[model samples]
Target: MNDGRRKVLKAGVAVAATLGIPFVARAQSKPVKFAALLPLTGPFAFAGNAALEAFRDATEYVNEVKGGIGGRKLELLVEDTGYDVAKGTAAFSRIVSRESPDELLFVYGDSTGLSKALAPEVARLGLPYSATSFSSELADPKTYPTIFVLGPTYSDMMAGLLGEVRRRKRAAKIALVYSNSEFGKDPIPFAKAQAEKLGMQIVAEEVTPLSMPDATALALKLKQAGPDFVIMQGYVLTVEPLLVRAAKEQGLNATFMGTYYSAELALMQRGGPATNGFVVTYHNAYWYDSLIPAVEKIKQFRASKGRSISYKTTYYMGSWFVVDVLGEAFSRAAKAGKLTRAGVVESLNNMGDYNADGLIRSMKFVNHRLPYIKLYRANVQDGRFDAITDWITVG
Candidate 1:
């Protein structure tokens, strides 16, 4: 048999041996339903489209190996949340009512607000949801439990960046700009606390909607604030160019900074010279780092499919994490002789410190969010984010 067929057959045989399910016989059975809620249309569509591609690819990978847990196929159901809270609510309702997926995977929310709105309902239905939002409020053990975040939380990323500022004794003056959303609003309290503790001056703060028609005026306004550095809480398109250009036009020499989502390769490319000397924080090690086993496998997987990994895309790693979590849950459920939603949840709860080939920090469910977030400092050089620190972890 060829290598591809042999790999699939081996995977099938291993799963069958573990679950004691007839491998070849049950391979053609109906797939277990899985749903993904992402913003395919509306404000956050850029992020949504990226995440959807990742989700689709990962699900397809699992199926290529003869289905997933219990020899059951994985059926992916996708719904567009439109980056609206009400639309998100309705889309979720439809997914639950119509598709009735066994698990929810690769959910994308714009900020803490929408995540909060949906957290209660997802838990009420006992659905296992993996999402992109990483606000610390969701980490509260009392409030949310069904939600699992796969990336570094905003709080964690901020702490890492701030720590570097302190280490370098560069806390002279700092300003803030944010999108008017749950994500934008989330860091106010934490930023206040951290800034005070670190003795960093918060010179000015500004907010604008996610899809603002005129950030040029706001960008000009930000330049007038006159701080030594500016930290932007925005996605790729919203932050890099607008703020950087304004800083230049106004002749403000403050260092530029951004959070995880805004650190994508597209931002650096589009921002051009403006992105130089700007620092942003991220969680995952650069996928281009082939030394990491899981990252290497991901590269190989893409190459095998006749596609080259692009710097503009890394959400595939997020989807890979989703599958890794599911695989852990599936293995546990199979060992226990049942593969129900509750069983999967139980397995997930008990999954401790999963490193997934050390591509990221170990994932641990603390309250409703994954507690282990690792931060990497990177600057834009030649249109890509280059890691500065070896790795930084949060409290």
Candidate 2:
């Protein structure tokens, strides 16, 4: 200590001692924050809202239940990007600049576009990035070291779908249908290659807009192609049902299928009769599977707060699965005493088979994405999805 400062501190201590007063040092516990860029108001509001709810509950579980990480409470910092790429990038920039690396452990972004746009920046900052996107492009650890996909890449999901096609009918004729967007088109090439590998034929490849100008025309085109099955990509709730109805009206007897969002319980309700035989692939358990521990925790937490729900969307369940994975990483990092971004990434890379109470099956990230998934068949009569196959590793 400097002499002048030391003498002043000693004089203060002596005065306090003579007055029977004691001096104490004060320190505040810091929070390990996971900053999120979510689209809470625009096109993807439904998704963002579902995810936000999970983030909130997961934060509570960590801090209140598990005593937080290394005694530093976990915090969720959300910046609404309104599903806009430009705004998402702006939020990422602001968050990285404003948050201290010591406290900011992870960042969760909205979509494939935002993930691609911020790849360079995330790598530069060395901040661990996870996203709602499962684009095949984002699975590259070499290019985007800090970025990871929450589930299997679209390509991996496609493999599971096409494998199902091959299972239902060897040498199955498959038609590819997707919206002409990044989400829609990301897995086509890979699907084609996988189809070829599995000895299946690509009968028709159809592209539609986010809003179908004429749904009938697309259905007629598929009928003309005469494929035994049609696989959809790049859409959530709109085109799958419409085209299935149109194709049925045309007397086309092809099985229709989708992956991820398409297989959601919401889609089953939305599609009605059209979704009866529709097939989809997913990586995690649905929200209604209350027997699962983590999901049970969500149910319990909400009920304790008088905000319980009978059911939630797939996005909600999927979002919780993401949080559980992050929690695991944070826990590992804390135990190792390297609760930083790099430390979390190291733990993630080496996280071989994580059993998060069956939120996901042996959740493992290969090439920064979960390569395992399961197949489900929608039963319109029950308004629920039934598992058709056990967990399959595709990617």
Candidate 3:
């Protein structure tokens, strides 16, 4: 060692010994970590469980397939919130308290309620967050700077659907059916404004519980409206089939449509012939689609562990996709030597037209949310939602 440097080091050690202090060398860098607060064991367990599975596999995919983030392994920290807002809030605090600010750079939230509740905290921390929700309320970069929707917001999807309606038939009469919750109510105002902008009439606004016990009442309202199209929101498989059958039986004869969540195969399979022509918007490639290179990679990801590939929900596809997107930010920031939460967000905001190997199409983020989407129609005989339109940027 150089004499000057050696003398300085010796003097530092002597000072530490005199003060009864321990001298320690610099600590090694640790793996990158992100928190996932999911609803793994409650009313939303079906969807949450699927997301959990995807995150686990995505962790593996990142560490093994993507060669780790910036040469450091990626770690996913998960918590179950039971699909309750209060439970989710506590879990969010627990995760924040536990992880070092340097490591916990992002979070994947389970629902809209939790996203709203945690908005201030997440933005204050400057850790980028994405959730299963596409609520337009969370899309504002000003109010919630660090909170980003996974894909198109519900408002964007509504605009796309409404625009398509105008294209097919100008000034189409539209009916809106949504649950009585925030998920249902969030996009209605924007949908109405966009409908009016496109010269379409909002003939009816039918509201139901998240799980409607019966569709007889709703069917009557829809039939009375005589809308050119009936768009259902805030429902998955439940109430969808019931409404379809009831509406058709009532001789309503209006086309039914929905957003991404309603684009599940289970919806078509369970709804049967009644859901044959039902349409919805989606932001990712289906696992069954052979042309996507990323879909093939999904198969390879599973086969590496000697596991057979089965049909995974879009919940799985979405959760898997976000982790990779976050990994990209982590990598970019790490390489630039500013691998902090803000650094990651800055990198992500500038990631122009990157599509994560076609998980979605080439697109740009507007207000931190990808507004590009495509339309799909349920082919009940095939038990899939076939793409009816190419990717289109909306709102």
Candidate 4:
């Protein structure tokens, strides 16, 4: 009787194992997918490419180190927006509907206008989004709770430049040159207000389309105004030629200041002698100095990839910041044993004081905006930007 019972038990266990019950359960793997919306093939391609590389690099590093969550590798999907509202909307729809990633790692767009348009859709889908936009409108917690910004707001960067303007005693009689797009238009009002508060008068305000070949007309107007300082805002295409040609032709002696977007080294190289002594607000710590531990790691990453760390690498820094924050949200979701859309959104809402590599001071779901601001004053000389002051932090 005992032998018969033992044989029956052994046979039952073997059958269960052979049927893929216990052993198969041990081999089961979780699935993870990450997707991003970026302007890969449009006006903002430069910034988008850098961000994309950063995300790919970081996730690759994480997977190589066996740091995936729940035994699942992080997968990434990317779509191009071209920095156009309609295009951005369509790209976002394709990813959310067709690809259907578990979470969004980075939605890279430099323009606040495009971000605003897509933020609503992201919220509608209840997906967490970490983006590179600093438009103040996106700061509202009620509006875009699932979205966060990795860079300082445009107004914050502008405020830093204004501080330098006062330090140089050019708060009065300053001319403003900006592009005619949303990126250029986003900070105009805040900058004007700050100018008034600092007793700096905006003597002349000029607009040039992002597609304009030359800024001659704007430069001529600026030269005619003869202001003590000239502050310009625009992407590289417009700002580079304007600053170079304006300084060359007008012999402009004013203290030149630029928004963060004007801090491209490529533009500075093109400006050559004209861009010397040109100061622009910078968001990230210098990528080359490697003085800080965070910068050192970024340098090591650049070298490993056979790429030189430049201001462009900060795009990677910005993108990495996005992933780190989103990772935190996902971690919270995983620990809670639920991956529902509401659960992730709640985790993002309650996020507090999370910093990735010191790139960001703090990011919280406070008022649905990450109240993080740090700015550095950098001037272009010898084909590169040299930091002129200690990093500045603003609210």
Report the number of the highest-TM-score candidate.
Answer: 3
| Weakest 10 consecutive residues of candidate 4 by summed lDDT | 100-109
Candidate 2 lDDT over residue span 1-395, tens digit each: 69999999999998887765322221136678898888899867988998898788777877887788767778899999998899999999899899889889899998888888898889998999988888999889999888888788999999898888887799989999998888899999999998999999999998888666457888888888899999999887778878887887888899999989787776766556876888899888887666778677788878887886678878888877777778888889989988889999998887777867787777567888888898989888888888899889886
Off by over 4 Å in 2: 1-28
- Residue 156 alpha-carbon offset, candidate 1, angstroms: 1.6
Q: TM-scores for all candidates?
A: 0.83, 0.92, 0.93, 0.83
| lDDT of candidate 1 at residue 302, scale 0 to 100 | 71
Question: CA shift at 148, candidate 3, in angstroms?
Answer: 1.3
Local accuracy of candidate 4 as per-residue lDDT tens digits, 241-322: 5565665686666767776667666656566667667777765555665665666766676678787665555566667767
lDDT (Cα, tens digit) per residue for candidate 1, span 1-395 = 69999999999999878787555455436556666677778867777787787677666666675257566666677778887778878887877777534444323344466778888877777676666678877666455555666666777677776776677665657787887777876766687679778998888888776755445676677667777777778554665676686677767887777787776666666666766777777666566766778777666677788886764265556656576567666657767965566766677777776766665666666564554443343345545566666666565
Cα RMSD of predicted structure 3: 3.3
Backbone Cα, N, C clashes tallied per candidate = 0, 1, 0, 3
- 1-395: candidate 3 lDDT, tens digit per residue: 59999999999988887765322221224788998999999778988999888888888998998888877789999999998999999999999988889888898887888888898989888878989989998998998888888799999999878877877788899999998877888899988988898899999998888886789888988898899998888876787889998887888888899998898898877777889889899998788987888788987889888877989898888888888788787888888888888888888887775787788775367887899999998998888888989889887
RMSD of each: 8.9, 3.6, 3.3, 3.9
Off by over 4 Å in 1: 1-30, 99-111, 212-220, 308-312, 371-381
Q: Can you give the lDDT of residue 153 in candidate 2?
A: 91
Q: Order the candidates by TM-score, highest first.
A: 3, 2, 1, 4
Task: Give the Cα error of residue 35 in candidate 3, in Å.
Answer: 0.7
- Model 4: CA > 4 A from native: 1-28, 99-110, 301-312, 336-353, 364-382
